[model samples]
Target: MLLVPAAHAQGPAPALPTAKPRPPAPAQPAADPAYEAARAAFEALPEAQRRAIQDSLVWTGDYNAVTAGTFGRRTYEGIVGWQRRQGVEPTGILTVRDRPALDAAGEAVRKSLRFTVQADPASGAVIGVPEKLLARKSPLPRGTRWQSTDGRVTLDTTSSPPGGTDLDALFERATAVTPERKVTYKVRKPDFLVVTGETPTGRFYIRHAAGADGIRGFTMSYDKTLTAEVDRLVIAVANSFSPFPNAAPAPEATPSATLSPGGARPGAGAPAPFAPPPLPGSVARPVATGLALGNGRVLTAAAALETCPSPLIGGAPARLTLRDPTGALALLEGGQHAQGAQPPAIRVEAPASGEALVVLGAEAKGAAVAPGTAGAGSVFAPLQPGAGGAPVLDRSGRLVGLVARFPATPRLIAGVMPPTSHALVPAGTIAAFLAQAGVAPGELAPAHPQGASLGAAAAPVLGSVVAISCGR
Candidate 1:
């Protein structure tokens, strides 16, 4: 009888095909007829489908952060797609095949317009549980379905109903719910995700989901706070997680051995390389920031730009400019302003006071800009592809890197670049580089925002080795 120790959710497993979010042109008026119409159409959806969407809607917008219901917004498309999944077409220009669905969907959206607060009754705080959006299929052949629920849960594949419940707690109980077949989300191998923002409004789980390049999915960001408990269960799940009838032993890793003059100690002959042990949830927060700049320079870190260029061309100087999709000027800055110095593949420097940098963080709502201080200039979003295209920023909104490697490519997501090569170039080294390029001290004020946060600065993992039972 496992219990909900509290907590929930993970990055979306590879998302199924989704509607192409028609991003609205930037700098638009607060009210748009198209947006209102579409919204009305959605709010007016049928009660059942609307209920599913409500359950699925892990509201990510910050509380009180009023969003201009705009056309082509990613969130909008995602929401509309949810309606489509329920069999509705919602483009404003209603197609003949879409009118009936549109009329029905619009009515549902209208009737469904009501506040939904998934809360932790204990804290009275609104809560978000990860949508049972399949993180990925389990290795188990029987497959997974909701068994049953109450304060506790029970499971049997066919004998179940699909309904939304406290996903956080469900995830907690699912970790060790017995007689409940163990299920392994084999593909969700542990990886790093940076936690960008945490607030009373909500947390964000930002991740590069599956093969969907450049794009990321936003979850309620529950895992950020409940990580410790989540991870403990994740490990237990890994070991016991089995939908697989005949389990396969994880293949042996190439064992390592040091050439000690004599054969090493009793058990030291051939040992595995020191593997970076998994974090409880094998999850980490993203560096989400809102440091926006006028010139399209949304500040972030070199770590966030890890996917930009390979062997990552750092130290070598380069120039960058940020532009919004509308071709409106955002920010114009070079990677390096050195008069004659060749652009290093990477440049490390401290952001001058008042400059902007983005939080290339782990939370959802893939990266956003944050000003060094509030009310200063905000950071810009990554400029879409085009001329004078995009200029990435450091924490202080100075030029840093670019989005060279998009998710569109076949690259499997992995770790980021080392600190030295990233947007957060070291203050000490950056100071020198500035001078060498003839940049005067007074030109930019130095604000040494440590590129490292919560756990970035390397820390030791200390533990006492122990052996435990497989049946755990």
Candidate 2:
């Protein structure tokens, strides 16, 4: 699990496609009645048949025709030739009788790519995939992932974040791709967003929609040379795509390595009086901030768990519990004593964009608090390293969010670029995470406008926050 902002970040899978959506166009002038009618009738045909018609026209030497489902001047001229070839009078329009023959001809062209329908029970995404080309498939964080053996094609399905994702955020991620010669097309309706473009790597298509079930969509990419055939295959996948209840079993809990009175040992029932081994080189053992909830439950950033074999809170060993695979939240158990006295009364409250807030676990002298502001899904605090799991509080000391590092655009200083800044997981995300874990938070109300000094406001909550350390 990763702790980056779920609203903007793609799911946990490393190879999944990211999208940057484009702006919607303004309303256009009304079209001629006759042209509009013909366009509508053309669009009414199956997308496959329309594309097939377009390809047939191109194959028959109508090089100016684009396969898009529209009946423009070039397309009309191409249809005339097709009509003449079918022994019908050249009306420059296709009729019901001509649809089948067009499809049959299109099918003949697509036969070179043997396609098969594959059902992903885990994510409930059933799509027509080119089994002959892509022989490897795997399950991803929120969907299924597939790739061709030769690495030419890739496909993925994605699920929306917990509190729902803003369409603008989704659009921004999709359009970030770059190439010297790039072309993009975007469509935004009341319910869904589609972004497709050609980058240096390949032709990419991304679709995102928020329905009653949640935000769900798919992405596909192929070598530029495979555009025509790949277009047909993806159309079939889109038409058949659907989601059902996720039926995969939950993963078993990971055992926390326990420390003995003598020394350190792996798991339970082990002899003591030995030093613990170092954590694997792959995982980073960074110091992080942690928040104390009641009943030995502590909440922190998921990034902190990436390599910590045994995570420590206030010098006491803590147990790993539930974590959100799609966002930056993790729930821990058995560390209430680390907070000193009773766990501080923590409450959830949403803060305004520029609300006066203090970050508790930030590296500061004495009772000092690092000042910051609330962003869309995170906080904008210039926190020191190791503040990943700190608590964010309002002037009155109510919990507003958890401090976590999130992806930010890089900035250049002198001649080199610096890393993105850290942010807080907003209260809305905290609420959704705890709700899923069946933990009810205490009543929290917005604080009154305040004028207290930073130290005075932060002192009360500082005692309840602790720095987390990790080891093998």
Candidate 3:
């Protein structure tokens, strides 16, 4: 049975209108003392502070309020809304007492963004970092390097040359970090040098200093999609970058700072180990969402695949293969444990802007659905960390896209950056990829079988969704 178009879906028809429009309410009296005092306190804040407050509100999804330092009705309403969320009275005013809560909220955001200072006493390297974004800091031949767990961000500092190398040599070594990178910026001076470029996978920025102290510098490589935060991070990292007093290069290490043919530092290209810290009470932990494609195949996020050599889908072991970086998607083959698996078929058509869509995946307990609206190029949905690589389906249960998690652009939400959000890769991209690999994806589930409701049509597909993992 075919499902009726949403425009004509059956429902109770409304009776003829009989009531007249109500009159507008009378204007309220002057602002209360509390509100007035709050406004004064807010107005006293410096421009930057006001902007920070505005940014915090924006992170809470206040598209109506402007970040300008001026206090207005919109900003007041936003503050009231936020206060209500905090279980506080909607006073529409920020009291000095609110400072603690506000700061705590900001700190939470910072923690979410993984913003923390990394100080290596041994390497004499101290730098600011997004801790949540990076893992496994290790001593490099010259200094130290920290790679993002997902392989999207990298930061490394090279040892100081007791007397910095000449500008020419520094320039050569810096540019060679990523040979194929497209140089976006270059500067050469007698004592300082910098080079920036973009690679197929991401972008890299290199800074070198030469003087009596020798060459002490660091490079930042990150995913291009995070350009906004990248700029700010670059600035922050550089400003905070310093070597402790008497900091000197470690004894002769690796002779060269050159990268391996793979464009990663030695022993740094591979993903980290798959052993996630045991959950509280020694329980197991789910790694990522996996889309069961049937016929002994499943799909999951590329990041999850990176660290797991032997991943499990629905308690069935699977082998990882096929990775698309541009699409941020991964495919796994072999999952014989799941019974009655039925993967949704690809729609082969893009969703219209503002169209309602459903994102399916298994997060923690079992399968879940995240409702989303189609955006210009992707579907915007509220997503959790592990929902990457889930199938995105239209109202009729046709596969329109795949979910991907990308590092959100860095912005001060409170004190930290926003958590990564999910976006849907259109079906055409997936189809083209499958075509290139000579593998056909799952077929679209039959729509409205037995006059089933949308929820019913979605159940089987969700049943095929699994929480993937890598554990002993």
Candidate 4:
């Protein structure tokens, strides 16, 4: 039986009743020439300069960097911008500070471009492609059982290894340093899709190293075999590991930064959908309910808005704006903080970044906003729009640490996808599944089987699954 996701079960919804969904938009027909050109330059560049060059690429997929960027896979503009920030003239472009100290630091980042998968950097583990898993040509049959050594395959590592890479080496390396994490198989194009109120969580990934633009719009459907293959992986992995307990946060679904008031003009090739971040010690006037920030903006907790005890809703309608001390609104967007509340958020980054800022929770409106807030030592109030959470801002007016992780309440049960005895999905695992499914991994929406008892805490066994490994 197919499981359909209720709008709420998928994610936080907007305030407007007829708000449209935000995924499966049509992708630009042509966006691949970048790779070929970059590849040539990469092969010609010295090893020292190569990593810097690869890092400069603005491709959409992660694994694509592992593949295409190895040869060439970044946009010239994005690379130039990254290099300029790195303090290298490459071709003698822009420079921030001529101080030797800053120059040396920028050079170090350029030099440290390993472009390789980090092996649980703390644990000394290496993540890489599973040769055997990639060698398979045909799809596995439905109901095919795979043995798992890890009993917690559904939620954590409750499931054992399937025909993918054994993460022992990666795990051991990162064992003491970072939390244990392993990269596994993914569907190049996934069949199963998890549609939420705003975005669709598709369970697969397709690598694209050199991309000049963001994945604004795209769509796909899976064949039966591919669909089943992708399903098997999701059942076994995806959101499996709770690195920070309840840390399966997705990117915010909104638009951000474009024009600023008072003549602070946008840079060349300004991105569509923009929202600058708040300057230090300043706040944005919450307009039209919410705001966005960051080049690739961040979003605050909207679903948590309703928690505000005395939410004030009566006001003349206005263009929603995300602000900082400097005060620059990116775009006019719609957001729903809660039924009766409002959580103001905005993006400051460029649309070209192909990044999203979705926060799980924040400091209460009464507290102070910080540079970032994802770990311990932070007090987050229940995210009720306008009630409060930590403040997030990018250098230019970007809000990075956004999103509200409201406590598990009757209305927010779907917002929390606990690892079950049957399924566990992680970010990296989802990437692999997307690769296998033959679709862009992050492009797909969240997927869950219909009638599946999500209430079960632990994950299941003997089925493929995705698992996230967090630092214990």
lDDT of 3: 0.55
Better of 1 and 4 by lDDT: 1
lDDT by residue (16-105, candidate 3, tens digit) is: 223233234344456567667667878788777876776565444331322445665556777888888888888877667765577567
Alpha carbon lDDT at 455, candidate 3 = 46
Best by TM-score: 3
Clash pairs detected, candidate 3? 106-415, 109-416, 110-416, 114-131, 114-132, 161-215, 164-214, 345-443, 345-444
Model 1, position 167, has a per-residue lDDT of 19
Question: How close is every model to the real structure, measured as TM-score?
Answer: 0.25, 0.36, 0.36, 0.18
Total backbone collisions, model 2: 12
Structural RMSD, model 4: 22.8
Global CA lDDT computed for model 1 = 0.25
Considering summed lDDT, which 10 consecutive residues are worst modelled in model 2?
Answer: 1-10
Tell me the deviation in Å of residue 407 in model 3.
4.7
Residue runs of model 4 more than 4 Å from their true location after superposition: 1-40, 46-75, 86-159, 162-186, 189-472
Two-way TM-score contest, 2 vs 3, winner: 3
| lDDT digits (tens) for residues 1-472 of candidate 4 | 0100001122332332222232242332564554555546545655544434332231211111211223312234444445565667643222334233333543353334222222222211122211222222221221111222321111111111222212222222222221222212111001011221101222222111001111111111222333433332321122111111212323321111111111111221121101011122223223112322211122223332322222221121212222222111112222122122222222322222312111221111112111121222122221222312223222222223323222322221111121111111122332332233232311111232221211110011001010100111
lDDT tens digits, residues 1-472, model 1? 0000011122332322232333352342467666677667654655454333322322311011111122223335545554555566544433445445444553443234322223222222122222232122222222222211221111111111112222122222333323423322101111112122234422222211111011111222222344433332221211111111222333321111111111111121111111111122222222122122212122222222322321101122122222223222222122121112222112344345444333222121112111122111222222111101122335322344332212211211111111111122233443343343333322222432345221111110000000010110
Sorted on TM-score, highest at the top, how do the candidates line up? 3, 2, 1, 4
